[model samples]
Target: MSPETTDLPLTLSADHYHRPAPEIPGAIALIEDAQVGVNLAMLQTGALQIAIDSQAVKPGDKLLVFIDEQLVLVSLVERPCNGEPIVRNIPAKCVPDGIISLSYRVNVEQSAPLKVLVKTELPGGVDPKPEAPGHFLLTPPQLTPTTLDGGQAETVRIAPYPGMRHNDVVMLKCGNWTLPHNVTAHEVGQPLTFTLSPEMVASNGDGAIVLYYTISDAVGNRATDHSLGLAVMIQTGSATPVAPTVSGVDQQNALYLSQLGSQTVTVSLDTRAFTAGDRFTLVWSGVDRTGGIKLFTQEQILERQTTLEFSVANNTIQELAGGSARLFFTRTDAKGGEQQLPSREILIVGNTRRVSATEASPQQAPGEFAAGGS
Candidate 1:
């Protein structure tokens, strides 16, 4: 038998129902990956609660999203709670200067997506660290005067070392205000030459002149505080005097004949005595002044002589005087040659003492004089 189709009545319960749609717009904030898992937050309102888990979010997580037609950002937030996602708002300007460390924990479940609006302003300046100060600021090259070899020069090259590159530009200046020449920079530790104009040379004369220079870097960052000044002196042609030579003589003589040892006889002379400015030498020797013996030769002053007299007591000449006695004398010539006189002998007989008298005679042969007579 065929069954007949039937319709039945259905009833609905109010206990099991869906939530109403949120009236306000749900906004999301964006943040950087480094900020994830750290404390962070974003500003928002309304019942559109934060959702993440079913959306798959975790601590230290990173996501790229848009923010209200302003700009897209990357953000990270602490772990979501239940099904809520955490979000934070970081200023774009703050991040450029330094990292904006989150000071508080952010709820990934309820907070909106991270969104940062960057405002435009004038270009920022560089700030040097306190520990490493900035270098001097140098400007573009300018013209300045330069002095070289005691003359003024219109052209000069400027250079810097350790911090400068080759073929850099530099400016030269005279005094504090006068600009003279713009020069090309060369490698440091090398010298540069500047040609002087007639007008510049005339003004500089022979006196030293001061010049200034500015050394710059390739990036246009100038360091003018290191300006240096150079002094140029004129060269003169002349010769210097040489030092003179010096010498001395010391000798001693005896009045009697006896075995002799090295003698230190005192000899003195005035340098001014020689009309020809000739030098003389004084010699001491075991050889007698009469040419009996020779020990050594020494140099003495020209034209001047000093007398040295002493006595020796012994059995040899004692029969002639009460004891031994003799006399000796030496004369030096302008050419440093020494001339000796005959030894003068004295005798002592009974109670009488006799002195031999003889004038120094170079004409007689050496050692030819009588022992007891002149």
Candidate 2:
């Protein structure tokens, strides 16, 4: 009833139609809603628009906004700047000739400073390589002999044992890190010799035999295994033996025995003066008292004095006619010296019996004289 009550149908798709305002036009813009459309006239006029629905713009996104009529652009609004929303502006006609490089500053905490490296690939497959730094290696020197006597003098030539040459130099290597050392010719031998300070010798002990030596090689290298070592030994004196003496009645009896029944014998010497290593000898000849020189006896005595004592006994004796016996004695020293005592001369007497004749004639004479007178 109002204007004949006739409603016209609206065509949704067409070449030209009414459209909403663009949320973002050429240049760049931040929008709260993205469901809006741009005017169809703006599209025909080469105007660009893009929709965005963001609480905050992200790193990569498109943004659009209108700067003026007949000018449109496409832009990309990356990250926020200065804590504010970012908008990148672009023209719609053609891309700008200048560079559109991006710059970003980020904060990263580090305990150490950052290191920078520039790598470049050379042509013809050539590449840069890291080089090693120069270094020094040290070695210990070697000595001809490792042992030396403390009693020797310094500055003597050094020579090793049997296999070593007479004039060969005993060298010590100056290692990469050490100094050179040398010894004189007299310093090396079966028992290498060297002069040691009195303080060093006394520290060990008086009259102690000490040995010392060091080893090295040519380079400046040093070795703990090749280091010097020392040894020491103390000296002592020799022992002596004690002398001995003879005593008591046995010694006297021995002397008396030597003097008995000996011919051309000498007096006995005292046994007390004898030393352990002394020696003695004796010789004797004796004749029995029976006037029988055919049965004469000869004797020899040999004596050695030692730490221990021993005795020899002879029981041989010859009996004479009258119950008398003859004996001989000889004495000897440890060194084979001999002496003999005089032979003993003993006397023996026989028992005697006496007989007397009776005088029968005397009685006869007295009787005869009386008869004759009658």
Candidate 3:
């Protein structure tokens, strides 16, 4: 053998090229080893250079390499590619977003088919398992903000990946509603899209819609469960407006007596219009579990958009039992139009050493700072 032929590391066992003596005389059969492997497995660029293990190869023994599922014959040379493994890139047709395709160029000197594998690594998400070459379907990636506004036509796109072939069936389901009951993966480079009909809009008060899907190949191999589902939120219209009020308490309706403590509260002004110089009063009334009530009231004139914190003196925390409170707001507009909206309820619990007397005290004067106004 020339030095060029010696460059490839022999991958076949010494016994692979040897055959046992035939029990029957005139039948001199050349039994090739069933075991198969490749040397110089790494691709230089896009091309693969490999050697065959069979000794029966002739000077013109034809060799074939499998790229993807397609086969291309390679010219066998006494000195292949000038003794250097040539590189080859995967075809542009095989490259798709979020997909990693593995193409193997095997030595088909023997008659059996060789296997290739494809894998995927989705950033910040599950890595789909590699699958053998042939028919396969990939699971769609997770969709963000699974919710949608109702009473309108909407569209959502799922990330694309390998193993998704044209005409593959993609089934989508959302609570009692299944549109395009059977859709196909038809476009390349573009994400799979689903259209939500106006009829799909959620009605009947804040109803939730969840989207689930499954992908199947023509031969019916489905992507594993791990990669097959997603969820969506669907509504017919804007959520009902919540009245301008206090919401989200950092501390549950409770006061701690350790020190002059404060809890952050969210003043939700959902859709409540305000004009300049509006005067607002927040009245907090807590009723002890036994029906005894303690009241705290504060008033503030509007300045620009403001930041607010709710605080209570340690002495104040000492005066309440576990119960609930009602928040009443009185707003006076620039024209002296006073509006007393419906009161909202808040919970209150006392974490003091003991429950203080429930006797009502005069509403204290408002504080200098925006918070802690009595």
Greater TM-score among 1 and 2 belongs to 1
What TM-scores do the predictions have?
Answer: 0.21, 0.15, 0.27
Q: Write the per-residue lDDT of candidate 3 for residues 97-169, one digit (tens) a residue.
A: 2212122212332232322222121211222222211112434334455555555666756666555554345
Q: Name the candidate that leads on TM-score.
A: 3
- Candidate 2 wrongly placed segments (more than 4 Å): 1-270, 273-290, 294-318, 323-330, 341-344, 348-374
Tens digit of lDDT per residue, candidate 1, span 33-76? 32221111111110112222224455554432222322223344
Q: For candidate 1, what is the lDDT? A: 0.28
Give stretches of model 1 more than 4 Å off. Answer: 1-160, 176-190, 203-208, 232-374
* Model 3: residues with Cα > 4 Å off, grouped in runs: 1-147, 180-186, 203-205, 226-231, 237-374
- Model 3 residue 195 CA deviation in Å: 0.7
* Worst 10 contiguous positions by lDDT, candidate 2: 127-136
**Deviation from native of the Cα of residue 199 in model 1, angstroms:** 1.2
Q: Cα deviation of 159 in candidate 1 (Å)?
A: 5.6
Better of 1 and 3 by lDDT: 3
- The most accurate candidate by lDDT is 3
Candidate 2: Cα lDDT at 44? 31
